[model samples]
Target: MEQLHQQSILFAVGINHKTAPVEIREQIFVHEDEIPALLTELRKTLVEAVVLSTCNRTEIYGVTTRTDLDLDFYKDLLINFKGAETFVSREHFFASVSCAACQQLFQVATSLDSKIVGDTQILGQLRDAYAVAKRHEATGKILNQLHQRAFKIGKQARTETRLHKGAVSISLAAVELAAEIFGSLTGKTVLVIGAGETARMTAECLIQRRVGKILITNRTRSNADELLESLKKSNNFAGETIALNELKNHLNEADIIISSTSSPAPVLEKTDFDRQTNKILLIDIAVPRDIAPEVAECKNVLLKNIDDLHSIVDRNSRRRMADLPLVKRIIMKEMSNFLVWYYSLPLLPTVLQCGAKPDKEIQSEIVRVKEFLLANVSHVHKLAMQNGAENFAGHVEVVNTLVAMKNAALTLRLEIEA
Candidate 1:
C-alpha cells in the first residue's frame, strides 16, 4: 500500500572527505551495532531510507512525502545521530538535495569523490552499506533504482576509463610520506599495525620499498599470521607477526609504523612513545584514528592522518581531472536515458489502451454520429458520411501518434525531475 503512494521528496544528507577531516569525520562514524536502532529511528519519521556509512562518508538517502520537513531538520537529526558536540563547529558538514544530491551520489558511487580517486575499495564499502540497509528493509523503489543505477554507472566508469590504474590510495600515500621522512625504507624496520585493507596495502608498498624487517600486529593473532604468510610468498623479507597486546613493546623498535586498526578509540597514545630513542614515522590511516594527537608532540614521533595524505594524493587528482569531461558526458547520458524511461511510464498504459477515457468519449461520439447518419440521412448522404468517417479516422490516427510522442517526451521530463 505504501508502494502505491508515490513519494514527493527524495533527500540525501551526510558528511564526507570533501566536507570533513578525518578527525571530525570519525566522531560521526556509525558503528555496525548501532545501525538497527538508527534505522528504526528513521522509520518512525515515515521516511523510506537507506544509510551508507563508510570511513570516507556517512550519507542517508531517503524518500519522504512531507513537504514540511526541510533538509535542515534532517541535518540536525544526522548531527544528533553522530553527537554534534563531538564534531567541531563551523566545520564537518555537507548536504545536497534532488539533482545535486543525485549527482553527488553518482560521483561517490564511482569513487570520484573518494579520498583516493578511482578507489576500488569504496565500491565494496558502498555495497556493504547497501546490503546492511537492505537487510534492515529500509530501501524502496526509488533507492533501489538509484543504487542499482549507481552500481551500473560505477562499473561503467571503471571499465570505460583509466581511472583505477595507478597508486591512488591512502596506504600508498602513507608509504610515500614515510619515504619523504626517512629518505629510504631500504634498511628500516616497518611495523604495520592491523591486518585490514589499509594496513595490508601499506605493508605491500613498504615491501616494495625493500624494507629490511616487517612486523605485523593485529588484534587477532591469526590475522597477523595470515598477513605474514601472504607477505612471505610475495618476497623474502625477514618478518614476523605478533599479537596487538605486544604492540607497545615493539613500537620503539621500529623506524616506521603504519596503523589501520578498527579500534573505536585511540589505541596508540603518548605512553607508547615513553621509551623511544630514535625518529619514528607514524602514519595513522584509520578513522577515529589509531594514534593519539598528543603523540605528534614527541620529538621522535611523527603523526599523520588520512587528511594529511590529501596533498600527496593531489598528483593523482590532477591526472583524474583530465578525464572528468568524459565522466560527465557518461553521467548526463545516463540521466537523460533514465528520465526518458521514467516520464514514459504513466503514458505507457494509457497509450496501450489507445487513450483510455478520452478514447471512450471519442468512440461514443463516433457511434452517435453513425446512428444519426443512419436514422436521419438519406442514401445519397450516406456516401458523404462514409467519406467523413474515413477523414475522422485518419485525423484521429494522426492525433494519436502526435499525442503518444508528446507523452513520451513529457515522461522523460518527469523522470528528470525525479
Candidate 2:
C-alpha cells in the first residue's frame, strides 16, 4: 500500500458475509428506520459516518478526528445500539483505513464486495445509506465527497465493463435453483407472491425460462393485477391474478412458488400445503422470511429460504469475480481523483493537525508541519487569486500559512490565540 499523505482518518469497519455467517450478518442487519438512530449514536464519536447495512454486509464507512480511532468503538457501538455484541466477536470484525478505506467503499459500491460480485443492488443500497447519513447530518464534506465518488465509479464500472451485464442477484439465484431442480420450466406453472421488486425479478427470470403460466397473489388484488399486466406475455401467454385470501387454493397447482412479501410473519405454513403431493419447490426470498421453516417438512414440498439462495449466490459470485480486475481498475482511477481533491483542501490540514497530537519525540518544528503542512496543504491563496477574489476557503490560506510558519519553530498551539 502506498503511504497515504492524508491523515488516516477514513475508515471502513464491520463484519460482512466474508467474515461472518449469514445468520450473524442477518442478526445485525439494520432496517431503514433504524439508520437515523444508528447514525445518531455513531456521530457521537465518529466525525463523519455512514452505516451501510445490506443483506450481505453491515459496514461503517466513517471519518474520525483522530487517526487512532479505536476499532472497538465500532463493535461496541453495534453491541449497544443493535445488540450485536453476542452474535459476533473480534474475529468477525474487518477494517481498512485511508486509501484502503476509499478502495473498499469504491469496490463495495461497484458490487465488487458483494455476494453476487457485480450485483447492482449495492449501488442503490450505498445511496440509501448516504441519504440517511445526509438526512441525519452525520456526513460532512469528507464523507459526502467519498460517497459521491463511489456513486460515479459504480456507474462507470458498469458502463466500461461487463460487471453487471450478466450479474446474478439473490432473486435471480432463486430462479437458478428452480432451473436446476426442474430440468426446464417451459411447461411449469410459477406462483409469484408479492408485487414488489423481488417478486417482479423472479417473474422476469421465469419468463426467460419460458414458463407456461404465472399466478400472482398480493394482499391487494389490484397490485396482483398490476404485476400480472407487467408479466403478461404476448402470443397466447397464460397468467392470472388473485388476492392473498385465495393463496391456499393455488398452492397445489403451482410447480414452483417464489414469495417475497413485506409481511412480518410467515405467510405460508406447512398446513397450507398438506395436500401437496406432487413435487413442489417453494422459494421464500423475504428477509423476515415470508414462508414458515416448517414448510420444508411437508411431504413432497421442498422449501428454500433467503439463506439457501446464498449457495447459488456464492457460485455465481465466483464466476463474476473474473471481471473484478476491470472493476478495480475503475475504482483505482476514481480513488486517485478523490485523493487529488482531498489533499488540496487547506483546512483539512488544520483539522488533521488539531486531531493528531504530537507524540513522544523531539517536539520539534519538523515533527509538527513536515507531514501535516506539505502533504495536505498547497497554496490555497494562489488558487483563490486565480478565481479573481479571496473566497471563504481561500481566507484560510493566510491562517494556514501563518500556522505552518509558526510551527516551523514552535509547537502548534493547543488553541488558536484569542
Candidate 3:
C-alpha cells in the first residue's frame, strides 16, 4: 500500500503577505536569476517544482513522491535555502497538499489571494514563474499540467468576472492614496524612483491625474529614459529623466514621491530627507523598501510603505466582493477538472503493471500508458469545454466512468503484483 501511494503528491509551501510581513517576505525573496539554482536544489527532493517570488510573496509549488514530506519539511527547506533561519520560522509559512494546493495556486494566479484582491499583476508573475521553471527543465508532467491549467483558469477568472473593475493594483492604490492626500494632482510635481513596471504604472497614473511635472530616476539612466519615452507617446505630460545621483537635488520640489526600486537596501535614508522643509508624500511599494523607515520621522514628510495600502486594498476588495462568487465557481470547477485528471495519473503505472511486461519492455509499456492517460485527460477537457456549466452533470458522469476505469485498473494491477 505504501508503494502504491508513491504517486506524485502536489504540494505548495511558503510565506506571503498574509503569513509574514514585507521584511520577512523580502528575506526569502527569490530573484529570477536565483530560481534555476533553487529549482536544482529542490529537484533533489521533488519530482517537479516552480518558484514564484514577488514583492508580496514567495511560494514554492512542487510535486513529490515521498509521503513523509509535509508542511514543516518544506518550511525547513525554504528557511535553509534562503539563509533565513535566523529570523524566520516554520510558523511564518503555510503549506497545502493535493487538492488544497491546487485551490491555493488557482486563487493566487487569479489574484483572489493577493495582498490586494484583483491585483492584475499576479497573473503575469505566475506566467513568468512557470516559464522559468519550464525553461530550466525543472517541471515534469504534473507541474506542467497544473501550471498550464492555472494560467487558463486565471484568464477565465478575469474575463468572466468583474473582480478587476476598479483600482486593482498596489501601484494604482499608491496613486489613489496620493490623490486623496493632495486633493487635486493637477499641478503636483511627482518624483518616480525606479524604472520597473510598478514605477511605470505609478507614472502613468500620475499622468492620468494631470500631474504638472514628473521626474523619473533609476540606477540605470537608460531605463529611465526608456520609460520616459514610453510615457511620452501615451500622454502629453511634462516628464524628464533625472540621474539617480542627483535625486536629492530635486527631492524638495516634488509633492509626492513613489519609489518601487528593487534595491536590496534603502535607497533613501533619513539624512537624505532631513533637509527638506516642504510637505511630501512618499509611497514605497518595494519589499526591501527604497525608502528607510526612519524617513517617516522627518517633519512634514508622510511615508507610506506597502503595508499602509491595506486599508485602501480592503475597501476596494469589498467593492469587488460581488464578483467573488463567480470567480470561486470558476476556480472550483477547474479544480475539480484538475483533480479528476490528477487522480487518474496513478492508474497509468497500475495498468502498465497489470500488463506484466518483461523488464526490457516495461519502459515502452509505461510510455503507452502515459499516452493513454493523456488522451483520456484531453477527451475529458474537450467534453468540459463543449458542454459548459449547463452540462456539468454529464461531465461528472464521464468523470465517474474514468474513475471506475482507474479503480478497475488498480484492482487488476494489485492482484497481479500480490
> How much lDDT does each candidate structure score?
0.70, 0.73, 0.81
- What's each prediction's TM-score? 0.78, 0.74, 0.84
Report the C-alpha lDDT of model 1 over 1-418, residue by residue, as the tens digit.
Answer: 0111222345577778888877777888777777778887787774568777767887787766564566666667777876766564434656554444556778887887888887777777778777887898988766777788888888888888777767367788889888887788898999998997777788888889999999999889999898889878977888998778888888777998888887888889887788889888888888778899999988788788888876778877787777777777777666544433322332233332343554676555445434433342333123322332222232223234433544465478679999
**lDDT tens per residue, model 2, 229-255:** 876744346889877998999887899
Best by TM-score: 3
Candidate RMSDs in Å, in order, are: 13.5, 10.2, 7.4
lDDT of 3 by residue, 24-57 (tens): 8888888677789899999988889999989999
Error of 3 at 87 (Å): 1.8
lDDT value, candidate 1, whole model: 0.70
Best-to-worst order by TM-score is 3, 1, 2
Lowest lDDT block of 10, candidate 3: 387-396
